[model samples]
Target: MSDSTAYTESAKILLLEDDLLLAMDMEDYLLDRGHEVVGPFGRLVDALDAIPRNELAGAVVDLNLHGELSFPVIEELQARSVPIIVCTGYAELPEVKTRLQGLPLLPKPWTAHKLSSLMEETFGATQEPRDAPPSKIRN
Candidate 1:
């Protein structure tokens, strides 16, 4: 697939994941793809706060964040018509199936390519966001 980072320049991405390394890696990955990535946020409140005020194009969310499932955030994103992709390592996919129906659910340890493509696919190329190489950008 073409590097989705090309579309990143036009999309404001909100990333909510608690795993610090994973979050940071994804943030860097998104940055490299040229999309505006808000936060690899580990907290629900922080994510909730950041998503609305900004002109969000889409998001990649962790199903479990700091012992809290992301149902509420899903609701908010759905309400706002913001596209979201779920990333999780837990086995409770069925439990959250209702809220996550029809959305991309990327299991843990996913490829950077998949991540970037999903962002581009979700938001399209209309809206744009700040793009630059993060301190670290993995191939």
Candidate 2:
């Protein structure tokens, strides 16, 4: 595992992904980078439920959870002002383009280095883990 001393601060990051192996990979990578992993939620409902329960510095959301679209989860995160990174294997559909107009889209099959770079760019440098104050999710 890589050393965590490189970061100045750590963050609690929510992860919404349906693929078990991929989720694990991402969770491990984030943890290795010294950030707390909230959930590798495989279902949309679970991801939605997690939003209000944890204070997240950012989120990595897959465009689809199982067969269901994850737009609601994305919207909720946006409403809360939480930064987000969307990943998808499918082509950029019109809806995706519309919903994620300015948000970062991490295409599938990305490397850990790419993820690490993006995470840093999105959430800033990682640091030692710290407890975050509770935050509420807006309706």
Candidate 3:
């Protein structure tokens, strides 16, 4: 069996959602599940800045933020070979789909359970929870 404990302890997740309420809920959920939440960045610029410097295991990104397309952010994350789950309302937007191709798209109105399962599948989660609080870098 895989070492679930070690997996959870080391994985750091990036969250790039503009919705304040949703971001808070996601951050809390990820933190409760034992992973470090790198950012609940409300804007694309902040997310782009963090992605290159931070040691991210994976990312859950919203395609549209503050009425702006987040394609550049997605491209940067993809360039770094960071696994991404596109959590957005614009999943059907042909432009976005064409750009992303086969990346996982988890539509908006997501549940903690669904997000947790995705994390577990992508990066693995453990029974153990982290002691430090989840981080937030909104701008």
Best by TM-score: 3
User: Candidate 2 overall Cα lDDT vs. reference?
Assistant: 0.74
lDDT of 3 by residue, 52-133 (tens): 6776777888888889988888888777777788888777778767876887777789986677677667665654556775
Per-residue lDDT tens digits for candidate 2, residues 1-139, read 0122132345678888889999988777777666767787888888889887777788899997767888999889888777888988763788668878888778898687767677778767553333543322222
Tens digits of per-residue lDDT for model 1, 30-136: 77666667776888888888866766777889999878898888888877777788897774556667657788878888786666566556666332333555432
Task: Please tell me which model should have the higher TM-score, number 1 or number 2.
Answer: 2
**Count of backbone clashes, every candidate in sequence:** 6, 2, 0
**Who wins the lDDT comparison?**
3
Where does candidate 3 clash, by residue pair? none
Candidate 1 lDDT at 50 equals 82
Model 1 lowest lDDT segment of ten:
1-10
The C-alpha stretches of model 2 lying farther than 4 A from their native spots are: 1-8, 127-139
lDDT of each: 0.71, 0.74, 0.75
